[model samples]
Target: MGSTSKMKVLESLGPLLVACLGILGCTQAVTLEVKERNSTCIKAELSALLFITYTTFNSTSNVSTSLPDSTSVDAASSSCGAAGRPPWLVAVFGSGHALGLSFATNGSFYSVTNLTLQYNLSDTSLFPQSNGSGVVTVVSSSVGIWAPINTTYRCASPTTIRAGGAAVTFSAMRLEAYMPGNDLSPAESVCTADQTTTTAPPTTTTTAAPAPTPPGTPETGVFSVTNSSGTVCLLAKMGLQLNVSYVSQSQNKTVQELVNVNPNLTVTSGSCGGTTASLVLTQQTTTLNFTFSMNSTTSKYHLSGINLLANWSDMTAPFSASNTSLDYLRSTLGRSYMCNTEQTLLVVPAFSLNTFRLQVQPFGVTASQFAAAEECQLDQDQMLIPIIVGAALAGLVLIILIAYLIGRKRSHAGYQTI
Candidate 1:
């Protein structure tokens, strides 16, 4: 925090750039198999074992101040040391506006050329976790700026992450290009009004909001979708992870698996006709004309569906919406939540978003409910039953005629009599 300390970090910059292998020598080029790049910006894959998600990075975005995996730390004499170069990222979790970011290289303050390019949350309070003491120099031929490596920002455009954090990508972290001597700060992902951190709700004296109606509590294979209420079809994802209150209409009362591709993309598939369910996920997205149609193995019947628009934000109104666990979430993290800005603290007043997405059949029984509904309807069609019965009767008469023609002739009359 003081220049004496900062100067030590600045002293380590420049003239010591390492191009050889890291001390641990873990800098192997990653071998990625089955990397499915689509025209879409993001893609995901889900199977019985491991789940994978991949997003294309047309550009670089901000790293929020909270969560992990955002910042790198512990620089010792070289960038190759695990303790020298920080390697962390940000997650959409935690309790407040400011994320904890700290990185120390060789226990000395430092000045480095560049910090990672980031889609910084719009927070005035956040400061670089870097030690701004090094007498470092930066050289970016494109930007045409060559100052002591005391810079914090990489000349990255902000347009890379206009939608939100759930859809950001990265090209590289070249913070050293400019500031060569500063101690690195811990990278953090700050949750703004748009991003949210989760905390357990305070116990209320008032009766807990009646547990969300589970999928198939009072009934089986029943589900509901809400958006001022229409045919309730179109939507991709607004976080549909099953929660404890989730009701199962076909199998057990809980879900087995969930796949969230993005804020607007998700997939939840399961086998449910009894107590235990095996599930799969195909696609859930904010893309228009998204369809979800699958068959239920129980009755061996057919079912299908579609939504008009892509799934939108989960915010319903006045800071409320559906979430991964079927619990209602207000847009804002909540009041009394602290936001650290340059040593200042703040709290949210209210929250909201564009749209919300819920299940058609409780938390884990959509396909089965659909199949059951069809089966129940088929059973009720007694009038059609009689018509089908009549058709069978006509077929029986035809079968009798064919048999007589094949076996009985006038010459065989005596044999028939016998």
Candidate 2:
């Protein structure tokens, strides 16, 4: 009986000891490589991606159920702004948790449940700058299985990563084919999916089309970008193409480029009247140029210039940029910009949902169209009410005091004469 007991103890100890020894000996230290190229852009700022989301919250991390297959997707790289973050990173667009699986390509399953991910940047080894190399896509498979863990994310299809510290890692695990294009909600589009489905684009008038050039001078919008395939964004409605060029020359600012930075920027003509528009920026060695047009060929009119709309209620507008209380509310309560004021421009989609009046900066809009004057008139009135009341009270007191003093002096003089 003693010998049999000892044998059982040895068997259990042997596997445990081996695993411990392996762990200590393995000491796998992960290394990362950062490649910086002049291709990021010639401008001080360029749009690059940061998140490469794969899994999501409240969803399956099962490599098969979660990942999109090996296919291309017609995703909007950016929203409201051309340089927007990916979808998976935004909780409103997508987020949740699920189990994840890893597999090998050889129809073999290894360990399941060893990998985990967080949509938030966690490690430096994950997102490299705009090197155009680490374009990653999420996928799932059934064969070579690995472990999965729960995590959060913004968008599922994470692309165009910018300078980031946390890098995603898959340790010698192969992936399975996820369906290319699956019918998904806006949130699900962030995850990798088979890119086979074609969805209809939204019907909206946007300011991405090319402007009609006056026969006298052809002003083209130049975008001095680094490290990208030389392509252009055609404001199909605007019939304008923002040409991304490699400018060894100095940059120039066109009317359109000015409007992009400060949508209130304008030369003298056209304005942003719609909910959506595309703005491209370019700099020659010295000059910058931007052009305004509509989306696609559907846009026929070219913006002549921009007019500065008058700020009507300067006094009642935001005090000192914005109210700090509101900003704090947004930060702590997951709300919109708390610090925003009526005087500030509301370009984001959030403000569109609620009917609030705001004057577009005098930049990209016409003087007559964006007529919503500042609403600080009411605030100014409230401020003046107290002062007016105080002035009236002081005047009444002074009059009463003067009358009493005058009467007292007359009485004293009359008594003296008597």
For model 2, the superposed segments whose C-alpha errors exceed 4 Å read 1-382, 385-413, 416-418
Give each model a TM-score: 0.18, 0.20
**lDDT for 75 (candidate 2):** 25
lDDT of 2 by residue, 1-418 (tens): 2324433443444443334323433212221111113211000001111123222334211110112122112122211112321111111111222112211111111121112222322222332232223233222111112111111112212121111111222221122121122211122111222134555445555455465353321233212211122222122111121222121111221222111221222111111222122222211111112222222334222322111111112111111111101111101111111111222222221111111122122122322232223333444576789999999999999999999999999988887542
- TM-score for candidate 2: 0.20
Worst 10 residues of 1 by lDDT: 42-51
Return the number of clashes found in candidate 1.
Answer: 71
- lDDT, model 1: 0.23
lDDT score at residue 235, model 2, on the 0-100 scale: 20
Error at 120, model 2, angstroms:
21
